[model samples]
Target: MDVVVARIGKAHGLRGEVTVEVRTDAPQERFVVGRSFTTDPAQAGPLRLRSVRDHNGITLLGFEEATDRTAAEALRGTLLVADVEEDEDDENAWYEKDLVGLRVLTVAGEEVGEVAGVDSRPAQDLLVVRLASGREALVPFVEALVPEVDVEGGRVVIDPPAGLLELDEG
Candidate 1:
């Protein structure tokens, strides 16, 4: 199985570094120096990582093929794929790739919303849910709130606190 590790953004500097939107949870392990990855468009096979750095909170990557800013620019919007199996061992852990777009329902089987995005925070990750009534809610993706995650079933069970789901009503 293959998963997206990062999506190439605009070229950062003139050092063949391109800003990338990280998609994997283990960036430190996946984007390490000398690590090689395959591109989506098949521009080059095994894009070896030359350097990886953070600039103003954004991840910038330098690949072996892209030796200059112009070269990196050509790779804009390219997706870096990693050939690996999905790991879901931890009880409270869900990969970013799996959490996205999963449905969120109450314990009573009431439809609440669908996961729009996942925000990894220092304290706990949050699930940005797009509610049914066209409202966005930030539900803490904690074990207490979200006890069940059926990735294959494409749904999550959230036991929200009182007023947590009703806060969006104006």
Candidate 2:
């Protein structure tokens, strides 16, 4: 499984260097020279890092084949991905891929819906759950609401406040 790590922004300098918006927690070590990673599966080849340096706060990377500004500019909007070989298990840590398509239930085992998506906002993260009635509920992914998440059983137990889902009922 490959997880997205960065996105190519624009050409940085005269060389075939492009500004990269990193999405991964480990950026410095991941973007080292001679490192090769795929952009997309549909694309033919992987991007081989010729050189990597920080410009201001952003990461600038030069590819192996891309020689000039024109070549680097062509790679803008490419999504850099890294292969997830092993599961890095941490307490209370959940991968976005594992949460998607899992059944959402209450603490007492009342079925709410299936996990649709997880939105990471500035203030708090939201769990978008698709209910049995075909309606979507944006439940806050807080400690009080989401008490238990069983990844192996493919279920998430949420204790939402009264009328939280009812208020948005159509």
Against the true structure, candidate 1 reaches a TM-score of: 0.72
Give the alpha carbon lDDT tens digit for every residue of 1-170 in model 1.
68777888899879899988777678888988998898888964569999988887888899998899888899998989988665657655566777889988999999998988887554567888899988988888778998899989999999998999778589
Tens digit of per-residue lDDT, candidate 2, span 1-170: 78777778899889899988776556776787888888864372488889988777777889987889998888888888878554576657675788999999998889999999877544577899999999999999888999988889899999999988776775
For model 2, where is the 10-residue window of minimal lDDT? 84-93
Candidate 1's error at 120, in angstroms? 5.8
Best by lDDT: 1
Clash pairs of candidate 1?
Answer: none
Q: How accurate is candidate 1 locally (lDDT)?
A: 0.84
Candidate 2 structure, TM-score to reference: 0.63
Candidate 1, poorest ten consecutive residues by summed lDDT: 86-95
**Candidate 2 runs further than 4 Å off:** 87-91, 105-113, 117-147, 158-170
TM-score per model over all chains: 0.72, 0.63
